[model samples]
Target: MAIIKHAARQTLGQLIGANNPVVTVPDDSQRQYAWTKKEVDTYWADIQKFRLARESGKESASEYFIGPIVTITDEHVKSRSLLDGQQRLTTSTILIAVIRDILWRIGSPEARSTASNIQRDYIARKAGRREPIEYFLVLSLFDRDFFRDFIQDWNELTGKVRGVEDPKKRPSHKLIQEAYSNFESKITAELSSYSDEDSRLDWLDSLYECLIKGLVFVEIQTPTSSDANEVFETINSRGKDLSTVDLVRNFLMERSREDLEKQRVNDAWRVLLDKFDKREEIERFLRHFWVARHGDVKSHSLYATIRGDLTREFDKRPHAYTAGAFAAELESASIRYVDLIHCSTGVDEFDSALSEIKALNADALHPLLLAASEKNDYAQLQDLIEACLSYYVRWTVIGRRESTLLEENIFEVAKEFSGGAGAESILRRVCGWIPDNETFKVDFEEASIPKPSQARYLLEKVEAKLRNTEGVDELEVASSTKVHVEQIYPQQPNPELRLDEHDSWVHRLGNVTLLNGRKNQTNSNRPFPEKVSIYEESALLVSSETQVFRLWDSQKSRWRPEGIIERQADLAKTALTVWPSSSQWQ
Candidate 1:
């Protein structure tokens, strides 16, 4: 093990102070600035909590840990390349700039003096021609100019608004701008609340004091690239919860032995980040990618599994693993993953089936579909997508197996697809998960219809089969029309009709059907005959089928539990047609 040097605890002021003129630069491997307003709020809340504790004498007014900072010293530049903790460091710099601007506006003699000191010590060094340009925190190359401009002339930046045009628009730069505004608003609100100059000056003094003396960091510096990479992984794994993508990216680039390989790795990684801009979404794709390659890995075990697999690959062909080969695989797989997410199924029927799957929230099918997208068989892909949607509908709208069992079944399908099984073979594997007709019918009658959108989707699918119309219009109407699941039997039982026995079936799949927005308001809670008249005017087969109901006893012409059961039984049969079993496909 290489020796990693740990500096004594340093305050934010001491760390950024110009006495050493230490510059912390971001390398190509670092993620762009991604802290959102929520994260900034959390950071400020923690600081305020610390301030309150100290002021109340509940804790020391000295040294509170901000977090750890890991860096590798660059002998050539006489600086440190920050390996982790960029988010905290960058946000803290933004806070300092906020304080400096506030103090400048306050403009008492003492306030001006304090502001000057902060600018010189913490923000930037005005280089003499003899000295190099050094900043306290130099951002990644893409963002550095925008960051430099904001720091150098923040008052002007407030008016400039950082052009929203392309090339000028970057997520990190936007975050920097937003962070400045956030801190400025907070400081302004705080100062405006103070009644007297003395109180305002006193508040400023305490805040500055806390920033310099109280906020602390444990800084560790490694001597070599490998050591820095190792430390970065260890620190982030046990603390702060960096995403799996972040860890994997760092490992690939840092392990590349040659500059050529490093460049290749960086280029490949950038393509992926650009394709999937959101960090959370990229992390999700990474998990799905893992399932596509290996079998099933739990959410918590996902990163470990990836790291282990990459290590094994590196052992087999060190150069290939380090030279962007692994990253290339990820990029290719991600194309399919993105297509699955956006439902770019090329075929209209396949896309329609996918839309229903999404409305039903069958994310378990994503990994399998991602693998399926790799095949040249569009017809087969369509068959698989339809089968998966059918499985999900039966599992979700009807009844479900144990969640773990469902997940295992889907994972097996994905594994088989990856092992080069054709659509028929892989779909043959799916047959075990589809509910039988009797079970599906029983479950359908008893199942509570879900939210309006899902319930509409279910009814619309059944309606399409009933009318034999292509589902294009039905799907559009289901989404665009402000419709709801209208109960055929009103929720409030008809006292004259005596619907108490049917009360339990009121929200069941058979009793529910769709009606446009205000029509539900008009049609709800009416007598059975009045409700039937409203259904007759509706276009949906599921609803309009209600118009022809007959009394089992012509002598007693009122809605009853048996009537609800009979209608549901017919709807259940239609549902079976809409989501047919694999045997029907054969």
Candidate 2:
């Protein structure tokens, strides 16, 4: 008899008022209020559309479906724990509060009566003369106090509370406050445009009508947490409806039995989220974390893989793999994750190497770095970072493989390292991922870098390696002062030099060198004699080194196609030295 599970389609007003003596509460297992201004704007647009269609007589009064909400009834407490659709539910309650506040400001007798009804019916309810009005939507434990205070102040005609200084410190509180403030401001600005009470009354009436009769949701009430969770996952998995982080959070919290353990898990989860500016970064970090331990799981399969891993581990070793234990580990790893992102190793060499890797956007290697941070020292980490950068340049940049292939290789190496392989073994694994010398040489001869930033970075490194070789392995060149890449063979062939044949070499690494100033732009496309004098004044080793090289005949020193080819060959050799193969380290 499956306990006769029941579901029904209900209006927004009905759902809010559905809690007679009990409240609809988002449990600790659920995420906090996360609807941004964009979501609020979308809801407003829908409201406006519904109103316009009705007032203009374009359509009859019709129900506007928002979405479904899943809840499990708690018989002992007489409350329903909201398992899904908290974002929409919370935002709608905020919308109602905004409407009530606007009507209260109108101050007329009719407006006062209408506002009182709204507060009584939708926002809160009073059971007796001495009883305080209870709210309809009770947020999770961490956010409940703040959200209650906000709604209470609004209902009693008190002014709104000021926002907090640091939103990330208390994300749930901050989000609720922001939602109320944004809705109020937007509504005030909108109403200021109307000149008469009649127009304003009509607008208020329209909002009330739409809220009560127009917006609808399919509400499913389950008898147990497991059943409610199943419904939530099924509904959200079909689309980008729920975030992967939220899914994992629910999975973790629902499994914990004791209140203290649940609270610990909740606190750790909040700490992990507070470190990032956007929720998407949390999802990205989880993917990287999982890959570092388990290997390459596809983006779409990340949540499933994590869920599966956690379930299996819990079954095998419940004492070690409980939700609270998992959360503590995640929080610790998150600290390291932040350190990786900001390059805050406190060791200058490691910091500089990591910074260079960050500039290259070598996100694929992050899992490898995370694994290395566990056992490797600063110098060892630096070597790994340098090798990874060189591997990325030769394999992905020069060899020109798809970026996905790089991600796959990095994930594979990360799994090996995490599975008890030594740092040397991981280094060898990555070195093998790089293209062979013959392949790299062929690609290097034909490679052309047209992007200005990449060109500057390459030339700057080469200059640093050539000039400051004693103890300063890495130099922090001021970004504003970096020299421009000068194509010795003019990019747009100069009629004066009659060098049209080597126009293809304009963006090639061998054909480019950094000029000290804008003085070289003035010497654009000049013949070999004039450009040579410009090159002579330069401080770059590449330029100064080029000045001494004679032609193939050992007769003339000039910039020719042959000269470009020879310089590129020399630069290629230097690159091989700068970005050494892992075998060389051995």
Per-candidate TM-score against the hidden true structure: 0.83, 0.79
Per-residue CA lDDT of candidate 2, range 1-586, in tens?
2231667787878777635534456556677667777877787788878877766654554767888888887555367678887888778888887888788789887887787777777767676869875777777765666666666434344433333334434555666777888888877887889999878888888877888778888878788878888888988899776888888888888778688878878887777767765665677788888888889998898889889889998889978669888888788777787778778878888887777777666778888898778667667766677778888888876667788888888888888888889888787777777776767777777778877667677777777777665444444453536456787766654555445555466777777788776544557655455566667776677667654233222344334666667777777776776666666655
Native-to-model Cα distance after best TM-score fit, residue 277 in candidate 1, in Å: 4.7
- Cα-based lDDT at residue 241, candidate 2: 65
- CA deviation > 4 Å runs, candidate 1: 20-25, 36-38, 56-59, 74-77, 100-120, 128-133, 141-164, 167-192, 195-205, 319-323, 377-380, 450-453, 467-475, 485-507, 518-541, 547-567
Q: Return the top candidate by TM-score.
A: 1
lDDT of 1 at 153: 36
Mind giving the per-residue lDDT tens digits that candidate 1 earns over 67-116?
88777875553677788778888888888878887877776777777777
Model 1 TM-score, 2 decimals: 0.83
lDDT, each prediction:
0.71, 0.73
Pick out the ten consecutive residues of candidate 1 with the lowest summed lDDT: 153-162
